[model samples]
Target: MKKILLLSACLSIIPGTTLAQNTTAGTIELDMPGHFQRQSVSFDYVRRDVMIPMRDGVKLHTVILVPKDARNAPILMTRTPYNADHMTSFASSGDMSSVLEGYDNMTDVIADGGYIRVVQDVRGKYRSEGRYVMNRPFRGPLNGTQVDHATDTWDTIEWLVHNTPESNGKVGIIGISYDGFTALTALFHPHPALKVSVPMNPMVDGWIGDDWFHNGAFREENLPYIYDQDATPKNDEKWWSNHYDAYDLYLNAVSAGALGKSRGMEQIGFFRQITAHLAYDSWWQNQAMDKLLVKEGLTVPTLLVHSLWDQEDSYGAVATWYALENVPTSARNLSIVIGPWNHGGERVEASKLGDIKFRADTGYYFRKKILEPFLAHYLKDSTISLPARVSEFRTGENIWETASKLPAPDCASECKALHLEPGHGLGFTIPGVDAGAAQYTSDPDHPVPYVPRPVLTKGVTGSPWKYWLVTDQRDVASRPDVLTFTSEILTKPLTIEGEPLVHLTASTTGTDGDFVVKLIDVFPDQVSAQPEMGGYQLMVSADILRGRYRKSFEHPEAIPANTPQLYKIALPFTNHTFLPGHKIMVQIQSSWFPLYDRNPQSYVDNIFFAPKAAYKPATISVDIRNSWIDLHTK
Candidate 1:
């Protein structure tokens, strides 16, 4: 009888069903896929609005959805600042906006699987009471940040388990992007009911590396855009419409090869207001989840999901994962899944978004086969087995591989460093081969533009973009303003599984200079190939660091022109297993264009105020006495 009822409910939600109904709250309802019936399962659900209360005597607006028959079941929670109604309604309408939208009516799906679904608006956001605190979290009384989402989540869960009848008393949290950060925070003070967490592209660290900043260098183009879109009022579409217009203008300028010519300059004033507190002060430092993770530790199993091309939150995710894995804990279980997709590419093919062609339904396979099974096994305590170490989707090979540990190549330290000679572009040779250092002048006025790929900047829109094979630092090397370094081909596969550090003894002609290092997997042939598997790029990993922030993030000092200073910068970590017959390539450059704000050659109070006239071509000398990048290998 239960099976029959579920089947009927699912049938009512097929492509063309006249089952449209309106609720008192003006919510439009439509049936969604339900649980299995007979040979196959289906899911059907409904969406509604409800108010959630926080512990701080504040009411938060929320959107609630449940499987048509869900009662007395565990709850799968997602608290977000993004509009719940818009996300839910769009999911029901079948026009997928974000990855979370496809599962917007999660109530029905989880219920069909025997669980309840709940999505809430964080405090101070849309529909929620209490002043919205951006990334700032309230610590103690009113002494610290404005808001801490972890406490809000704890209160919300407490309210739902007690108020909402039929709850099985167990809760699992899942979210992407900012909401993903919220999901991570909930685990900080794991409720007795909280069992599992999936934080996808979570903003774990807000100050040093994130959408706002990268390697101490500010992401000039994207940061301002994000601030405008998120901070602006959304009562009407006025702010959003204007935001999109500006985005379009920026996009056009990028396409026309005129990057800084967009309306971004006009919005500089706004950017200053949003990020006025530039240094990693108390405001930004308070939001660093690494510190919080240590203070209020994790007590639940966590699945860290990320994409290699996640231009916004890639570094933060990697840093958070490493930090958590190191902390001693029995309750904390760390696992990672890295794909070749962009930020939202896991749900949709990147090619489709850019009118390119590729394999069909990459997103569906991951959701139904991988994600669903993981959630089901853990939440339901089913007899399904889970992989122990890593389950990665390799882009070049176009298949999934599981390993007890990250793959690494057999090699000695003596075979690691590759020298970048003055004339010879990039090739592997002994370290002390006397290959003179290359020089380049990074002018802030004409910063190098980020490599233009179709989907590199497609925010939240799951569009397939063209994937580049191995990154060719050739262009950067050929440019007079960039330096190229290469190592000899590895006789065997070389696996880099930990944080990469670049130790440099260098002197800059200016007060501050930027050092950008890209770890590339050089293919045997100049031309490499990418599979039609999905929108996966064939690059291994890359990172950058600012010289001023080398010694300390809080303090800044100028460098003596002729005197050498030992600057150590930690590049982003990677778990890549570089294949045999491939060479490890590293490119050292001072600029990455509008992706990061350029540093003026002059020693100024701020890079933003550095006049165009102050931008002068400066020479940078890198001493080889103790300059090298340490790669953790197997």
Candidate 2:
């Protein structure tokens, strides 16, 4: 009976009086319903809850918020897996900002622009009726089903433009993360009323670089998400950690698969898919949104928003931009805005990340200057001009740059090379003397923590993982198992506008291992402006790759023990400058524990099922003579 009540509470079953018997009256009375109908309240906007019918006769839960004086206003919509009711209800007052503070409403932009805001629960989520698939593949080779997110979005937009009498018949879709993925799908066969799309930090390709995996390494920290999100449609289930420190918890769990099994994740469909397709098989390839978008062609003006320090989906926005760069339609219709922010940070406060400060409220500026104008121009017929095809925030210089000054993606070919030379040094020219190798012992038993000790689970809101990308690198640089290569203080500013490629010829005593390379900017010893940040080691770009997948991401081959081989790790996109008096440094290590699963140094057929005994110590050596980094300069 207790379990039944708990389940009832979780499902939000209405409460009232239980069935009763009146023996004396010799008559029966029905259960009385709750008194919810008597409560009345007023809001600033007219809120309407409707279940819009899809092509397949499925009704998706949607909430529309229209301003009291709305007249022919454009509709700005976001279709989300996250519940629409919780996202749309923040206050009972007449202020739009108060009603939409938590979700990625871009409140000021919507409130001031007088746009009708619509939030909907995607099919199979919340109150929507259907089966839910994680990052549901398009209706093609991967998906044999007739209806997908694209079709659902089309049906929703069609309903909005026709049913909403106040709408001007122009619509724009905007969202972040999973919601962003849905927004990107709307561009597949865009409706005539769909005018523009803003996919902010979207999850494009899970196999290549996105939320699921990077290169060939799985993001084990995200396992909790799979449990919470896929356990049920309403997502009422929760994942609890036995240990407070994530490092200890993951270490004790032995392997991610074992941990997941202990948590009953084997029942989740998405978890099963993740385990079944560990490699970048056709399952992952066919669903890549970036590739799908290119194949379908860009039909609407799309603006991609990228965050320089985005902790999640960092590669999606930039990767999508590159994939669409050469497409004829993209040249004029695609625009990108890159800023210094965490995942979806552009929608909230963004003046600073971690210990670093940008000296201004960058989020407010972006919404007012970039997002608002872009929406108004395309959706409201405003004369405000949009930024260039590429608009990125230069970090150290702390200013925005448009396409006029943006350099090519691989301009490092023209700039001088930054080589990893002997005696822990980085120089413009290669070292003439032979430096044998830089060696370090990698022990899976005591792997390097991605962040400082006492690391908490990242699934919780406001966790340090949100800004862990910008955390000081000094913590790991001091460890003996890590290698640090530094350059002399810069006499002039060093600017880089694109990706940084790490090239290394390395060998390990075991057949498998992992390599993590970080490009960082070392602040000066003394700073006049901020004393706390003096000598801070800030990571500019970094990434990791599993050694077994060196030749190809889809295939796994064990490394020849003690034999030197070449490894190229491509870091994420960045637009930053190492100012004068600052130093440029690179750090290399084998593991980024708890964040990514430990690479059982020894060879294994499948890492997900690797045994505890398979994880052993290995000696990793980097041949300085053959190793160097190629930096794309401005």
Top-lDDT candidate index: 2
Query: For residues 1-634, could you state the per-residue lDDT of candidate 1 as single tens digits?
Result: 9999999989887876635444555566656657643321233544457787666678888766555566666788888777666656653232122213443233223534655667787776677787655564646632364336777788878887786676667788987778778888887666777878888878877557777776567766564354444453343322122333333433334321123223343343335433455567665666777676766666787777776667667766666665666666822477767665556566553332232223545555555555666776677657876644466664423456666443222223632443344453443344455745545667655555455332244343542222322334455556666665665666777665545666666677787878777767666664344433222223566666777777877777676775678776665545667666666666667877656666766666666545555566677776543466666654
Our model 2 lands, by Cα RMSD against the true structure, at 7.0
Model 2 has an lDDT value of: 0.88
- Model 1 vs. true fold: TM: 0.77
Per-model TM-score versus the true fold:
0.77, 0.93
Task: Give me the runs in candidate 1 sitting further than 4 Å from their true place.
Answer: 1-43, 91-114, 141-147, 233-274, 349-370, 393-415, 418-430, 452-475, 487-492, 524-538, 580-582, 624-626
Question: In each prediction, how many residue pairs overlap at the backbone (N, C-alpha, C within less than 3 A)?
Answer: 23, 1
Could you give candidate 2's per-residue lDDT for residues 1-634 as a string of tens digits?
9999897676664454332334445566656776545232455688899999999899999999998878989999999999999888887666777788776689989887899999999989999999999999889887898899999999999999989999999999999999999989999988999999999999998877799888888899999898889999999999898888889988999998888999999999888888888788899989888888888889899999999898889889888888887887765788889999989999987889888899888888789988998999999867888767777789999998778333455644565578888899998888766777999999999999988988877866556898899988898999989999999999999998788888888999999999999999999998889998889999999989999888888888999999999998878988899999999999999999888999998998888879999999999999998888888776
Task: List candidate 2 segments past 4 Å from native.
Answer: 1-42, 404-412, 459-462
Candidate 2 collision pairs: 44-94
